[model samples]
Target: METFDETDRRILSVLQREADIALEELGARVGLSRNACWRRVRALETRGVITGRVALLDPAKLGFGLMVFIQVHAARHDAEWLEKFGRAVREMPEILGVYRMTGDLDYLIRARVADVADYDKLYQRLIRKVELNDVSASFVMEELKDALALPL
Candidate 1:
């Protein structure tokens, strides 16, 4: 892992929330010159500290109001089963995130859809691809807090 100084942390903390901010302005915000900021950002990119920037979209505004968290128990814990499961989940656009867990649940899947019906379709598609021992879903009625920014 690459070690980052306080300046890098400040730069990253600011950039996380305002990815498209102009370098000159970003430099001012982070207390650095424009060229210095550019160089640091370039180094960050090269070291994989900064990944690609993307627009954050509202699921509700896009007609996808339902957010579901699925707890999946795998039928098999072998490498082949893991690969198949990963591939299956990765192919589904509705699935926003997939996480392997250390608890009773083998995997946790976060998905957004238009409604329960859309989620049903996604569930059907998921099961068709891989055999799961058990699948439990929780629908999110309200999101208390949702932020992609990491604490510096």
Candidate 2:
């Protein structure tokens, strides 16, 4: 595991929220020279601490206003079933996140669509790809807090 000092934490915290901030600006915020900041960021990237940066877009503006969390029970608890499920989800662009779970649920999927009709199409496409024992979905009424930044 990589150990982080106070300055490293500050740098990471700032980067997490604003990846596009100028190196000099970031250095100013974190109390370091621009070159020093660049060196630290390089080291962090080299150590696999800083991953690729991306723009977080508004789903509503993109016509993907509805968010749904899907609970799935696998047809079979086997490698074949897992591979098929993984492939199906990976191929579907609307599927944002898929997680193998513990307890009653076999897997959890988070996705975005236009509305009920759009979600139905996504469901139809998913079922056609792989067999599922059970599936249920819950639509998000309001997003109180949606974040990608990890706490430093």
Candidate 3:
């Protein structure tokens, strides 16, 4: 792990919240000169501490109002089955995250859709691409908290 002083933590915290903030402004917030701040940010990137910045979008605003968690039970546990499933999910735009899991479920998929009809269409498309022993879905009624920021 990379060692971080208080200044590094401050810079990371500010960047996590406001990635596009001007370098001068960011320096002011973190008590450093612009050049120094830039150097540290570059170091963080080089060291793989800071990955990449992205714009977070709202699913509702984009006409995808339904969020579903899908529990998938694979028909086969062979390498070929796993490969096909991975490729199919990678090509699917609606799938936000896919996880290999323990317990009763083989995999878990997080996805967004317009409605139940849309979700059904996604289900049809998915099944046509890969075989599954069983599948179940749970719709999110309310999202109390959703976050991407990791603690520094």
TM-scores of the candidates are 0.97, 0.97, 0.94
lDDT of 1 by residue, 1-152 (tens): 67889999999998899999999999998899999999999999998989889889988999899999999999998999999999999999999999999978889999999999999999999999999999999999899999999988
Identify the leading candidate in terms of lDDT: 2
- TM-score winner between 1 and 3, please give it: 1
Q: Model 2, 66-92: lDDT tens per residue?
A: 999999999999999899999999999
Against the reference, the lDDT scores of all candidates come to 0.94, 0.96, 0.95
Q: How many clashes (backbone N, Cα, C below 3 Å) per candidate?
A: 0, 0, 0
Give the per-residue lDDT digits (tens) of candidate 3, residues 53-129.
Answer: 88788889999999999999999999999999999999999999999999989999999999999999999999999
lDDT, ranked from best to worst: 2, 3, 1
Model 2 accuracy (lDDT, Cα): 0.96
